[model samples]
Target: MAGDASPAVAALSEAELLSRIFPRLAVDATHSAATLLGPGDDAAIISAPDARTVISIDTQVQDQDFRLAWPNGYRSTGFDVGWKAAAQNLSDINAMGARATSMVVSLTLPPDTPVTWVEDLADGLTAGIRGLGADGCSVAGGDLGRGREISVTVAVLGTLDGGPPVLRSGAQPGDVLALAGTAGQAAAGLALLESGVPMEQLDDGLRNLTERQRRPVPPLQAGPAARKAGATAMLDVSDGLLRDGRRMALASHVAMDLDPDRLGPLAAGVEPAARLLGRNAMEWVLSGGEDHGLLATFPPDIQLPPGFTAIGSIQALGIDEGPRVTIAGRAADTGGWDHFAD
Candidate 1:
């Protein structure tokens, strides 16, 4: 605590820290219409207009999920963690074809943590909720505690707006597989953050990659749009494409064959990083995750929803075999983020 920015959060009483955090999390009552009551209460009351609420939760841990300082000399900021917390949780609700309405975030800080960093995290959470186009969502309430490492957990609630929630098991053979956001850029960005290259030496495009790693932009609008367009099944590409695609295939009881030509643009986005890092861009696109893009399947007759482009098609499962994701009629490698594997 001597050299640290501020004596870890331990020095400040929980009430004292709450006093500092509340102001940063205040929301406009006009915009946060769905939240009947927010923070300062035992639990928040949210208005679920559709009478059904969709819920999801996700967690990020220090070092395991993110690093304070990277090999490239870049330091992870509180804002980065806060934004990512919002992104990943919101992405879960999005995958269900629902619009997020409220979120409760829990934070665990180490003894040496800086007060300024916590404030920045609060600011980042507010910014992510607004900047990421979740206009209807608001921070309801959360918990804080002392822990060995920084940890963040977010539980979010969403509304289907009276529509049926899209499920992964709804996909059928002959459905058109589509994607609604950039792929591989974030994995490329992660590579840049962990690279030995000096930050100053990176060009704007290269730096952009790192930005994605720090703050991913999940396509919030695409979810409802796909649902409106009758998307049969969907999920967020949080894990690598192959990994998540394999999941969708299994859930839908179908096989998926991605068109390499359709994936070219996604791969191209990471070429600069791939070349610099001596890695394969296509691999990044195929196996990379964390962009929070939507992966959905739509019926063959209708036009894909806005912000979506067809990348593949659903097919019947192979003879006596399970569902799998393939490229050019061959099973693709399922390599992506695996917490247990790591």
Candidate 2:
């Protein structure tokens, strides 16, 4: 119903559809190194040089995680969905301080979905893998099925490169908390879209913000870099800063004190959009999610790797404070993206 109704998936058999899409995916340079055996086989073979694999999976469903038509929705392209599907799982691997080496995607579509859309989605998947400078990673294989709505599930495989996986529970008191990539911009973009502002009238900055919300590009390299730099604890910021920070704090049995002053620079990028909407930029910075930036902690003496900014410090949990996160010396709310939150 969304695209041109002609040349739909129903026009061809499953084998016919695979013939059209598989070649586009198999030709990507990124897949060649990781995939020993690709499509047309019973299963794909991927290399795991580190003797251990870090795996993560994520799913995106139509109208829930995305929408084809809505002022507040992404009105997403196939590439956008493909890129985002890969990105979310890649970020998870990165959070563990590993390099993503391969992925398997599962897609479900309505009978009337366009074949071109599926091909474009494959292109987006390859683009996302190579986009992270992960030239060796590939889409191993996937399953396709008819469903009520379009849905994508991506599972990624990563390698630690002989390094220990960084766990959220390893942070210690005096560890310097750092962040890589962005915060708030994606949320601001969502707000702008919901505001019903005409996309054509938006400035370049606002356009970029909305694009981020639709398809976030997390710093995939930063994860392994943080691990190599001796990060004690880490995670990707899929949820809001406050929410994810609290998760790490609780896991580590510590408390975090985030300085508002230090977060100002990070919040600056969203200020224009925030002002235009008459909203507080800082709130977005604090509570906005889906940026997929890496949040990590390191020994106070360790120099942070490139792309990371020191934002806070870890502390011993006070008896009353419990395992919590604080901003500007006050306990912060753990409000963020909750799938079933009322």
Candidate 3:
């Protein structure tokens, strides 16, 4: 309790921690093999005889990565943290064109953390996992230790399900760039909250804006669908689209032009949130992060996969530089989220 910032962070008990945090970290049981051994005894084992296993992990630490006191209650913050961890990890499996079969989480926190906050964290992770229909992934196992701040790490195991994995380098110049899900809502929400605007003052239109900061619902189905539809290249919109799109452009060696008109429709009804904070909704849509949407490029004339809209087009290589982002034929200056740079 030496450096604990909140009273809630200092009141967590062992049983309380077990109930709240443990469930969220358990892996799914239904899809696992009968030969898999876990809990109760010495060590855990699994039989993956049929399909290829793909694994990915992600970790989060307080202050350096998240704030327990920002925007909302500690419970909401825990939920957001858990949801983000699950989304990022699950996206890695989806990127491989695989089905996530299981997940395990390890958490470290200050001993004084409240039991309720831990439970909320687990609930958030569960909500996110359910959204993906990742039935097999459960909170399988983890270890906890005393720490100065909360730290969470999740490892996800997936089955390729007999398909080829999509990669960032697969895009070509003739492909059409498409996206599913809104961009920048989280950033706008952060702005609103930061500017001292109360959530009650805003209408329902902006709820999604704030929610984006808490729980990012990734388009899990889109990756496999695009692969099935013969997408030439693909990526998840974890970072801002412009930044990630620039990544795609550089990786594939092409220029990208985005139609703001097309993007405008994708971000409909968020102006009130913008107005509340004296910010531009369009700027949020263009530059926000953590939406966890899907971004992909496909053949120009082919029918697009379901649930996606045409947002832009892949361009031929330019003589000027790497990954130019243009809006309505004019160059856009913003392209990324630089954590350390202003």
Model 1 has a clash total of: 0
Which order, best to worst by TM-score? Answer: 1, 2, 3
Which window of ten consecutive residues has the lowest lDDT sum in model 1? 1-10
Number of the top lDDT candidate: 1
| Model 2, span 97-204: residue lDDT tens | 998888888899999998888988898888877776665788878888999999999989888989999999999999999999999988998888777777877899
Query: Which tens-of-lDDT digit does each residue in 193-270 have in candidate 1?
Result: 998997899999999999998999999999999999999999999988899999999899999999999999988889
Candidate 1 at residue 60, lDDT? Answer: 94
Reference-based TM-score of each model = 0.98, 0.96, 0.86
Better of 2 and 3 by lDDT: 2
Q: Which stretches of candidate 3 lie over 4 Å from their true place?
A: 1-35, 39-51, 71-77, 318-321
Candidate 3, residue 271: the lDDT equals 73
Q: Quick one: best TM-score, which candidate?
A: 1
For model 2, the stretches where C-alpha displacement exceeds 4 angstroms are: 2-6, 27-31, 72-74
Best-to-worst order by lDDT is 1, 2, 3
